[model samples]
Target: MPAGKGEKQPYFHCKKLNSMMKNPKPYFLLCAALIVVSFPTWSLSKTATHLDLVKLKNGTVLEGHIVSQTARSLNLENVGGMISILRESIDRVITAEPGESAMFLGAQLLERKKFARAEFFLKIAAEYPAWRTESNASLQKLNTIKEQLEEQRREKEKSDIEKLIRRKGVEAGISELERRHSAEDDYWGSVRGRLHLLMARERLDHYDLKMAEQHLTLAEKYGVTKEQWESVRNEIVAMRRKSLLYGEDKLASRAFQSRKRPDKTAAGGGLLALAGEAKKKGEKVPPLEWLELVDRYAGENDVDPLLIWALIDTESSWRSQVVSPKGAQGLMQLMPLTAKDLEVDNPFDPEENIRGGIRYLRFLLKMFKDTDTALAAYYVGPGRVERYNGIPPAGREYVQKVRTREAALNKRFGLSPQGRTLSKS
Candidate 1:
């Protein structure tokens, strides 16, 4: 006979039971004893197989499967379907199979596209062969998806960089590239080297020779070709020599213009011309009286005297009574407001002016922590440098000029260890 739905079939066949009918009394007694002994064991085994134990702080106990848990709550599957219990209300959960619990959680995370976390639990689940094959397949798929997403991100980044270069020009583009290079996990050294070389050329175009040299050095470090390096090196040397000659001529011309009286003009012009000639003959000119004052203040402020000399040379050409068209005065070209802030009563006084300027320069150096940026802030304004994220376009030449003059003065005085300019442009 066929068994009905939800009915338990008898263990013995009807024909075998008919054979036992001859000894019906003994068979009935045996059947009753078997039921008495096996029922409790069957019930115990069934309860152990299907349920997890949950104990609560309120002295309540529950038997159910744990569906999921978070920091604040737990989802449980019970005979009542599903129930959410606040973690604060629960004391402990005793699951039947830890491996099965991990496998369930991993599957949930996989569905949510949390690939990294999913892989972690899935790897643990893989210790059980029942979950190993599915977990492995999911891990492979997760890796593939991650790779595709990364490739798409890189393509978008490259496209954006091209647009930036075209729209904002090389300096802005290089700034963006540097920011991205620092943040990216897989940085492209070749691309960075090419961008650095482009920036070096731009600096050269602006006559920022020291900055160009630094960029070229970085380019070589990042993998510029040797032939390209040599060509750039030759260009830098030629440009530097031309720049030095031009600077000397400009200084002499400015000195000639500073003297208004005819008698003093000839003497001043002659002295300036003699200085130029002496420089050409590789002879050192006598130091200005103001140099001693600058050294004293710079030392007192722990600032570089050569840097002050460069600033003075660029600002007023070492003229104590000179004033700029912009109303900056004295040897250090202190503006009226800045002079007041520095407590300088007379901007015409060389000692007071140099002291105020050196104090300000030291402040800028400490604030920016880079020589080029500090000079840029001094030349334009700190606000402008902050706005531009570096030296402003208008001030690049000024920064380069000051750094170039500083290098020269340092070399002449043997103040720098390497006898080379240290520009952080």
Candidate 2:
């Protein structure tokens, strides 16, 4: 009674479709599962082969292409660069397992100086072991490029550096320039070093031989190498001889005319006065909490007491309780790993922290040459900071602030009845 298609039998297509519509859940679930299973493989296959890495738990990572792949060790293109982390030493790969790969591609891109591109690839490469070696290479290379870029910025910035010279003072200029040498940039101090050389030159220009000798001595103390130092010394000696023989009064005014100090409390100098003034306010130098403890610890290590004092002031404002967002701690703000390496029983203790901080400073000095470079290290974790080619924002502020305090110490001691250390007769 109900079927009336000219009294025809039920349609087979309608029957099959009606049956499917009755329970479509299985079909829907199967389609979704296929997508879920296939998506990652598609994503992986989509990667273009350029830079790749094989990660190993052993101290080494491999950088090259995946010439072949299995769950186990993959073939790497080249194995040697200067560092020991080179490829010849990769004894094992993921325990020689099968059907496995981890490639850090983005890191590899960075090595090629494709930062924007590397940034994209590296983000993905982080997901695979093959990319780790490349990723690390990329990071190291990227940092190197960043520094190169920063240095390129400075050559055009000579006038800016010169303007800063008046504000940064002798110490600031020294600090800034020395940092460049240590960072492998070698440009920051070039101009100032020239100025210092000019001091010797001006002395020779005039016949005031004695004053020139003193100024030359100061220049050498600022970090010129023995070659540069001896050269300056010889020039000074030669000029004195010439002046004595040829004439005196002609250039006399030139030698006698020394450059005047600019404003006392400008640039980095303002901070320098603060440390001393803090004492006047009844807040002890290095703070009573840190001063005694620093001496006890620093003296034990044969480290310079003043250098430790300077580092702490720069690192954490002498606050034993301070902590950086990066988890650096104490008056000296040692990163936890560094604290462990230095064997500080308690990183927060003023004595131990200063001791470790000073040791670290000494290490940095040997690593980079002079207090200025060391100060940069303490402020931003050593020569790595030079990757930015100059003082980073934090490092710049830290250095100025510390130098200001050190300057205050110099002033206080200079005026004190005790006076500074005396030269041997």
Candidate 3:
């Protein structure tokens, strides 16, 4: 017995171990062995529409247009042929549900890179996770690009930002500057204005009146938005007048208090009573914060708080990020162009949107020289108003709705005792 060969413990492994007795290939085989542990693996998926596919662990998706199927392979047609998968690669096979045949068919078209055909698919995709996320993410990326461009300009080309400020703000002979800028051109003038105003504010904040004055002059050279220019001019005038007369602007602030507020007259009445009940249960718009922003913005812009309330009600039902069917978006339901005109970076901010809308309301009133006509212009459009020379039917409807809502809001706020009347302005 040459030292019982099976009695010894196994030797350590090498790529190719060789013992004195002979080759120890069995030892190396043990070293080559790898224990693979896979975590619970499953794929999230969408059912196949003719060409729609789901990738499996093997990196191949079970694919084919189901003309007819057999026990082994599908009667698939790619570039003119039938194909087969060994079923091992398929986690499972799924087809679109019965009622969703057309929708799935559309998705199939999209997956095939049929851009035109994809449109129909996308419509269905709106409700589908795959399409919704893809579209929204794509859009969000584009918006981010725009914001980044602005940020870059803000840093590298301060002068551009300067132009934006001058075209929109005033710190000195700003009114005159604005008039000249307006007279110069009309395109992107508002942008130049905000830059000017921005520059002036920065300078003024740093106690650089000379720099501030220069910005105001540039702003006038470019054109500030009428509102911004007016505000700045008023400030400058007030400052100058105050220095000479030693008078204060006299600013005061106050808050509202919550109470058992309910409208007692109608089914919706008894806000005071409701407030009392709410106080007992702790649910109410605190009187201290009670539409204070609405009041302030309205007062400052010489707009009706009730009107803002009405706008909010119609636009979002108080929802901040609501986007409308007509593509009007955010709390105030501002159209893209309108929001841009207002220089609103974010419309979901209630205060920002409200101020912008009310400010525009003021601007429109000035343009039409009549409040009712201006409001009509707002609901329909300036173009339509100019074309029609009066309120359009749509505008009239909107105006009535807004007016009714405003009246209700006025009653709620205790601002108007007799509700509203559509008296001609």
Q: By TM-score, who's the top model here?
A: 3
Query: What lDDT does the true structure give each of the candidates?
Result: 0.65, 0.55, 0.52
lDDT by residue (185-272, candidate 3, tens digit) is 4323234455556656644433344455555655665566657755654454333333223322221011112212222242323333
TM-score ranking from best to worst?
3, 1, 2
Model 2, residue 84: distance off in Å is 30
Better model by TM-score, 1 or 3? 3
Error of 2 at 237 (Å): 49
What is the overall TM-score of model 3 with all chains considered together? Answer: 0.35
* Model 3, residue 275: C-alpha shift (Å): 7.1
Clashing residue pairs for model 1: none
Model 1 TM-score on a 0 to 1 scale: 0.33
Q: What is the C-alpha lDDT profile of model 2 across 1-425, one tens digit per residue?
A: 45766775543448766565678788779889999998875654433343445565665565553434333223443322111122333455432211122233344445565454454345445555444454555566677888899888877566655766899776777676665456432322332233345556555655556656555555554445667766766675455444444455745655446433222222233323444456788876656545655545554434555556666666687788899986889988887856764557899887778777766665565546566666776666643555655456767777777778767766654433122211111
Best by lDDT: 1
- Lowest summed lDDT window (length 10), candidate 2: 416-425
